[model samples]
Target: MLGYQVPSPDEAMLIAGGKNKGSTPFRVVTGHGAFVLPFFRKARFLTLSMMESEVDERCVTRQGIALNVRAVIAFKVGTDEASIVAAGQRFLSDQDQMSVLTGRIFAGHLRSIIGSMTVEEIVTERQKLATEVLDGSKEEMARIGLGVDALQIQSIDDGDLGYIAAMSAPHTAAIQQAAQISQSQARQAAAEAEQESQRAQAEYARQTAIVQAQYKAEVDQAQASAGQAGPLAAAKAQREVLAMQTELAQRNAELRQQQLVAEVVKPAEADAEKTRVLAKADAERMRIQAEAAASHNRVALDRMLIDQLPLIVREAAAGLNGANVNILNGASGLSEMAASLVGQGLTIFDSIRGNLNGSSAEDAGEPDAPEPERPQLGDGAHPRPD
Candidate 1:
């Protein structure tokens, strides 16, 4: 612990006053520990960490425009033994000079590269200019045991000359015009969208009002219908009651008519029919009695006419005797006279019988039988013995 030496991760240990190898005067130890004898060896450290340097230089371009350029270089001591030895021998006495020397080295290369390019090339192609500068400084940096990781052109401007500003004027004007056009288009679109939203809100309000009005109308109609329901039902019930009463009255009228026919009309019709039958029987009995009586009277009348026939003959002879006294052919003439007188008496008897028969039929309330005609006698006479 007293004399043992170790290098930091970013540093290399350089041990002098010792036997070393390969064209070097000191022993370099990195990333490990080493033992050093007291007073026999002097151990020192060289930084191997990243370092930065900035260069600001004025140079005229190929277009003869004087431009001020600022650039940054990132460098470090190499990790190899040879590069470490070289860096330690030159910078170990004063480590702060590494940044100073690196800045001077990159500044020279920056002036040289800027001299070969125009102002436009330097401004627009900053990366190309940095690359060329880095390439041109590579071998020189390696000789001093330094390596560059990157070179960046920080800025390039013509101080107090206005050359760079003049060169960018046209592009700046075009970009400004394009931005103004885009802003105008966005404002117009916002205005149109706001108008459309207002129209949609108005339409929604109109629809809501219409729907509410329709709902109110429907509710009113329902209320009116509900109010009328009871009266309508009562009227219908009254009509039904009236219809039933009318039907009952008609049924009672029909029942009364049927009762009248059964109680009064039926008995009267039967009595009338019985009376008509009895009257017909009585008339038939009377007709039979009349016929019997008429037959008996006709028999009596015939007997009486037969009895009066001789008397009538005598009277006829007597009347003849008084009237004439002449006789011819004597006995035969007298017999002929007697026979004519008897025939006249028989005819007179028949006439009296027919008259009595017509009178009997008239008294019996029957139609009269026709009378028989009487026979007429001749005007010839003969006298007879009285």
Candidate 2:
């Protein structure tokens, strides 16, 4: 088991000291089982995997400036029978030395590439420098049974000379100035925008105040009109009331005029008719008296007395009708009462007729008697003229 080896995928197993090994000089084993019978077999491992190396070298650039360049190179043993055999023959004893040898080889090529380019070109165009180094070292690496995968220039420094920094100063200052200007412009624009916003707010506030004032003025005017409306309406109603009162007064005056016309005119008309009738009666009486002066005076008196008889009876009956006579004994008391009333009425009539006859005889005897001798007649009695 100690002499029996199984190689890994990244390794090649080389064997010597067997009948097939020394006679064949060497045999490669890869990714399979291999038995080395212990004493008769000797085996060594050679790596075929990828490897990387770093090279730091101080080289003179085309500008005669010394620059220290650090670079990394990726390389591997070629996947071919010839390359694997060649690598195995050389590095089978010390597999770790492959990276060491690769570093030295690329160091020389990196120095050569940097020496051909300027310091500016070496610092700015690192890929070009790496490409040149890779191309220059390609043939030398292949002869050593290696293949280059990638080459990168990690850093380039100009030792004590600040040539690279000096070259970038103007551009760096210009960039700083541009950044400062952009920041200043942004601040100025923000200030201007803030000023504009404040101005707009002030304008809006002023306009709002103006509008409020106008609105308040309108409200005050409307309130004043509203305050005046009650009195104005009341005054208008008062005018209407006054007009109605005036109409009532006019109506009352018309009614009063009509009442006065009825009271004064109707009574005056009745008095005028009565006066006319009285005047007519006086004329008829005077005519009768004049005619009676030619006839007998006693006969005229007798005629007048006969005409007054009915009026006297009616007055007596009217007086009796107004009298209140209570009868305790029904029909007999009433009959007695009626007889007494009839007797009194007859006696009154006879006394009136006697007075009238006596006055008529005296008037006939004294036809030229004085007015003081005439007497006034009582109710229901006719006048006796002298």
Predicted structure with the largest lDDT when compared to the true one: 1
lDDT of 1 by residue, 222-287 (tens): 889878977997898999999999999999999999999999999999999999988998899888
In order, the Cα lDDT scores of the candidates are: 0.85, 0.77
Distance from true position, residue 283, model 2, in Å? 75
Q: Evaluate model 1: give its TM-score.
A: 0.54
Error of 1 at 230 (Å): 5.9
User: Per-prediction RMSD in angstroms?
Assistant: 21.4, 23.0
lDDT per residue as tens, model 2, 131-226: 888889989988878899998778787876888777778777888888889889989989999999999999999999999999999999999998
Q: Please provide TM-scores, in order, for all candidate models, with all chains considered together.
A: 0.54, 0.52
Off by more than 4 A, model 1? 1-3, 37-40, 223-386
What's model 1's lDDT at 287? Answer: 83
Q: lDDT of candidate 1?
A: 0.85
By TM-score, who's the top model here? Answer: 1
Error of 2 at 71 (Å): 1.5
